[model samples]
Target: MRRNIIPIGDVIAVNQMLERRGSALRVHMHDACGGQSFSLRADDGTSADEASRQAVGEFFSARGHAVEFSAGGGDFWAVRP
Candidate 1:
């Protein structure tokens, strides 16, 4: 039951908005000592699912994550991953 509301500010950041709408994010957080993860993305505009991926990518970059949109066939388009 994850959601897009970070609650940091009334105005959600561009990256947050992008992540929310583009469906391009997932994460595994760790309060322990370490963490690991993976993600999948579609942004070719070839399918409805990829429609917002571009926005998500932009948002991720804005948020300060190193993003590779499609170097990998299933590049973790998800910003969080």
Candidate 2:
């Protein structure tokens, strides 16, 4: 999986486990830029989902983003905005 790490601030917080509901492949962003939700990668397969999730977490950490993932597991990447 490949994802572009956008330099946003602390917005996402919480661990999302996509084992049950699979996973969210993309999301829409409503801001001044104005554009549809960007599709960074495909989260359909099992490993793909895991890779995407880990990438997201690492992306946030690399940018010093203040976010947290679910402690154990879940199906959604919880965020706080």
Candidate 3:
């Protein structure tokens, strides 16, 4: 299975929006090949980074994929099965 890497810029933008609104948000994406998909929702009241990670991690875990985040803080990739 091919991996799906979420861009850092996208994550950073989403994080910034969540931080500004202090509200819940959802992000949905499908793999380039259209074989896999993910939906993530982040609730309000937590740090943007943490909430984003939790949502992304849950999406991957439910689909039996491993979640990996970049060291710098604003990106993630899913290791496909």
Candidate 4:
């Protein structure tokens, strides 16, 4: 499995956002983004759902970067932020 890391500061920021949002952030399967299939999974063996994906995407976008994934089983890459 391939791995990617979001900086500790970004992580903390996301956590703080989640903490502030509380359970309202929980996403249902039907809310997935276009029913996209993600080959990359976290260390916990879970893949990102739509809400989390959007959050991460926004985080990187704010830094002038974009996260990309292959259509099949492949690694994740980020553009310069």
Model 3: colliding residue pairs: none
Who wins the lDDT comparison? 3
lDDT (Cα, tens digit) per residue for candidate 1, span 1-81: 111222223124643564666444432121223322223323433332354545545555555543444454333322343
For candidate 3, the 10 contiguous residues with the lowest summed lDDT are: 39-48
Off by over 4 Å in 2: 1-24, 27-48, 71-81
Candidate 1 vs 4: which has more lDDT: 4
Evaluate all candidate structures by whole-model CA lDDT and list the values in order: 0.38, 0.38, 0.54, 0.46
Which residue segments of model 3 deviate by more than 4 Å?
Answer: 1-48
Once fitted onto the true fold, the runs of candidate 1 whose alpha carbons sit more than 4 angstroms away are 1-37, 41-48, 70-73, 77-81
What tens-digit string does per-residue lDDT give for candidate 3 at 1-81?
567565545645554555575546544455556543444445443333665666556654664657666564444556655
State the displacement of the C-alpha of residue 41, model 3, in Å, after optimal TM-score superposition.
Answer: 13
Q: For model 2, what is the C-alpha lDDT against the true structure? A: 0.38
- In each prediction, how many residue pairs overlap at the backbone (N, C-alpha, C within less than 3 A)? 2, 10, 0, 0
User: What TM-score would you give candidate 4 relative to the actual structure?
Assistant: 0.43
Output the better candidate (2/4) by lDDT: 4
Give the lDDT of residue 68 in candidate 2.
Answer: 39
Lowest summed lDDT across 10 adjacent residues in model 4 is found at 23-32
Quote each prediction's TM-score. 0.33, 0.31, 0.40, 0.43
TM-score preference between candidates 3 and 4, better one: 4
